[model samples]
Target: MERLAKGRHHLANRTSLLRMISAWESGARDASDPYRLLLCEAYGKSPDELGLGGGTEHVRSDIGLAYLGSLESATSALGELARFDEMKHSAVILGKYMPDALNAACLDWLFGESLADLRLSGSKVTSQDVAEVRTMTENLDRLDRFLGGEQCRLMALRYLRERVVPALKASKTQAVGRDLFSATAILCELVGWMAYDTSRHSRSGTSPRP
Candidate 1:
């Protein structure tokens, strides 16, 4: 109580503290964001590691609306996300369509498009391009294992915007196109995972509306 009073928390009074504790213990109320933050500070662990409500509860949103119809759309969405992250407006893109968008894109890659002849006048995509994308993705996966998915979020977006997406705009064989699109689908899932992590951490106050 004294620490809370000195720290300017709303639950600084002993009476309020007792009531809050009683509520939490009796399951009448779950801890709010502010209380969860204070508890995290007290425990010196992450919310998920501590099993806080932020980790246990699901965040609802319309992220499913972000459907990816082609490699072009995937690239554009990823570019937008990269720009948003740079502008510190990442929260804006984390909407309800995320899961659906990822699912659609993945399905497209897995069983949808056959990409028989991506005919272009300029230089055609070769095995080297596919290999490069695979290498970069593998590297990104390694980074995720070491640094956690959140750490790779911005870099993943940047890579998709600059490298993979641009490659999509270039002419490629049908086979090469298929490979590129499949890789792009995987990349979209990566971005979605990052978005999920971002949403988990930023979730404060009320749960997201469906």
Candidate 2:
């Protein structure tokens, strides 16, 4: 598979590629994006034919309503939610709220076990990173106030998905992890508020996307 990937100009470390292949085979991870393309090329099959693309749509539509138990889970959930919003799928944009799901999520959040300290091997997160996220969130909040949620929601989702999610996955000290989590929570809350505003406007038949 590494040789095949290399043939397709996708250079990756042999050990890492082997591990990724193992994960994909065992269903521990989904083959995403470039890997999906590479695998399709190597196997001469479409992503749907390879069973790699069918489940994502369902998963994305179902994301963001569950109670995430840890920082890692929270990060993954937030990333998926942002991706779902960014896709602008009409079904998701106008989907009805599930009262039962909201109740269950609230219960789980209230009763869930405390998150363990994050200690992953990746880029280090710092106070500066947390501050940057907070600053961005504040700016986006101002925009939401001035221009409305429909105008600023996508940008907020994009930043959260592209920048904040990766930072949440990076290595950080306990203190920094807490700070980062707090900053991320603020951003997530802002995004949720924006989503709510957009939904309300949509239901009133007054929301117009430009």
Which one wins on TM-score? 2
What TM-score quantifies how close candidate 2 is to the native fold? 0.64
- For every model shown, what is its TM-score relative to the native structure? 0.49, 0.64
Stretches off by above 4 angstroms in model 1 are 1-64, 68-75, 90-123, 198-210
Candidate 2, residue 57: lDDT: 49
Error of 1 at 136 (Å): 1.3
lDDT of candidate 1 at residue 80, scale 0 to 100: 45
Write one digit per residue (lDDT tens) for candidate 1, span 1-210.
346435566664678878876876575545554566677687787655665442232322322243344534444445544443433332443333334454654576577754233224456677788788777777877787678755587677677766765677678777887787777667666665665665643211111111
Question: 12-88, model 2: which lDDT tens digit per residue?
Answer: 68798788778777865566546777778888997668876535545644455567677566666666656645555
